[model samples]
Target: MSKVSNRTKIAAALVGVLALAGSNLVAADPLADVQKADGQIHADAAASQKKVDKFFDQAQDMLFEYGTVADERESLKAYNDYVATLVADQEASMKAIQDDINGVDKLRQGVVPLMFKMVEALEQFVALDLPFNTQVRKERVENLKNLLSTAEVTLAEKYRLILDAYSIEREYGNFVAVTTGQLNLDGKDVLVDFFNLGRVALYAQSLDQKTGWMYNPETKGWDTMDESHLRELTKGIRIARKQGALDLFALPIPAAETAK
Candidate 1:
């Protein structure tokens, strides 16, 4: 009919070009891509949040079941099954996190501070309680600090190491050991048998079994115990080291000084 307007011709040409290049400009599966990305973000958030939720769930369950117990076997069974399911779900959620962008860095920012605090607390405990294997303990704390600073070590491994340290420290409270090391006795480095009696006492025995000293935390010095107590100290060490039978014996137990 009538001649088409120039504007209409230009519009038609533009539409043709867009159609030819549309595949390159626009994503073919935009919704699919969005769904995948959103799922990943959600999964990552869920992964971390689920652990907290599970903890609270256990707490609440305990609170609910504390005073109410209609059927012992049924309740116990149900509770155990629920806990198992929660654990499985938590594992699945963690696995579902996106490989490229799982918010682990953000988690480490919060966790690194906690790890530092734990280490500091550990250091203080070692300082106040008893200075046994001190250099070794210091090295362990230093290693943990260095590991935390590195990018290669994962957060989980760091946390596990801290827990292991704590466990070792706790286990120390239950056991005694006889280790020989250098001790500064009266301004002299003496090679002595350190008798660690489960944080209850710390004693140093001379090579000739002639002298014994108890650790004094106040001045960080060693006070020589009475030679009359030598038999008791020897028996105690023998029992602790499993070299002899255990029997009741009176040995020096260092009293922790009250802070002024």
Candidate 2:
């Protein structure tokens, strides 16, 4: 073989080796691609961490605002409860007042007639009684009757007057009274000493102790009393007036209900 041909073959072999090495360098690497993908994932994680930090700060501010509102909410709720209680009490009180007002109208109707009946009963009692202090008692009854008819008098006032009259009649039954007054006997007026004995009996005597009479309820008049009755009746009047010593004396007694 010629030296030139041999040199050409060696050169060709060296060129082929260089070309294979160049192709190997230009080929794709799997490890390098994996590294590039991991770097991209790390960048995404950094951005997400920044967003979480900002959200945590906002959450802390929201919690602080809620705490501040919690204390105010309790105070406002307590004040509202107090107001509700007051409103309930006011409604109940108003209802009670309305009920009282309604009852007053009914009471006035019943009490007014009752007061009139009481006054009439008092006048009848004065007429039936033993005719002592007649003018004063009759005047009281007349005053009560006039008050009942008057528009200026209230029912409560009329009722009080009736009760007072009844009390006076009741007191008259418990004791004796001796009075010097004008006595009408047989259509003639005479000054006499009157003996009132506990709503049971009434005896009248002249100043000289010579003339006397007993009251008769059925006939509504005065009748002449016996001589024996005069001694006991005169002594009773003197004793009642504190002009004589106290002593038990024989006297006629009758049960008469003055208050009734």
Candidate 3:
């Protein structure tokens, strides 16, 4: 009986040892599966973080490019505005210049007819004034008439010449003058020295100083001067010619006509 009991105890101890070893192996396999799943999760997270970092860098680059574009647009806009202002100023200046040109044309039209009337009035005044330098004065009037008819001379030039002629006529009334010319007396031409005392009187003396005459504006003729006045007339002629010193002298002048 003792030997049978010993063999059974030994078989039971061997079965317990095999069951404990199987349990340990199953637990170790489960633990190893959990560890592998955790490792895979950590690797996936690291890869996702890398992708996020790349996306953030791309976004930052886009933002910088947008800012650069915006600044360039502003600069271009300011340049365009400046150019537009310059164009506006040029347009205004051109309008003003056109207005000035139009005004000049209108002024030219009015001034032309006025110049003609002024020249005509000058001719009439010269014809009615003192007969001294008559031929030259009439010739000036004739030349002015010819000038007015021509197209070669400018209006301003013609006007300037007419003014110069009027200035010369005005100067004639302020001084004495002497010249030699022919006088028609009693249907004969006589050589004589003509003396003009301003616009006051006109006298003629023969070359020999023997005969003298004064102009009669009332009759438009030469009146024979008396022998008594001949000496004074000779002295007056010499003074006008600047051949003698200035002195008081006598000559007849036509009385001014009263206003009618």
The most accurate candidate by TM-score is 2
- State the lDDT of candidate 3 residue by residue for 38-61, as single tens digits: 999899999999999999999999
Which scores greater on lDDT, model 1 or model 3?
3
The 10-residue segment of model 3 with minimum total lDDT is: 251-260
TM-score leaderboard ranking: 2, 3, 1
Candidate 1 per-residue lDDT over residues 157-194, each given as its tens digit: 98999999999889988888998889885677999888
Model 1 regions lying over 4 Å from their true place: 1-106, 256-260
For model 2, residues 90-182, the per-residue Cα lDDT tens digits are: 999999999999999898888888887878878887887777777899999999988888899777777887898899889988988888988
Best by lDDT: 3
TM-score of each: 0.57, 0.64, 0.62
Q: Whole-model lDDT for model 3 versus the true structure?
A: 0.86
Backbone clashes per model, in order?
Answer: 0, 0, 0
**Residue-level error in angstroms, candidate 3, position 257:** 2.0
Better of 1 and 2 by TM-score: 2
Residue clash pairs of candidate 3? none
Better of 2 and 3 by TM-score: 2
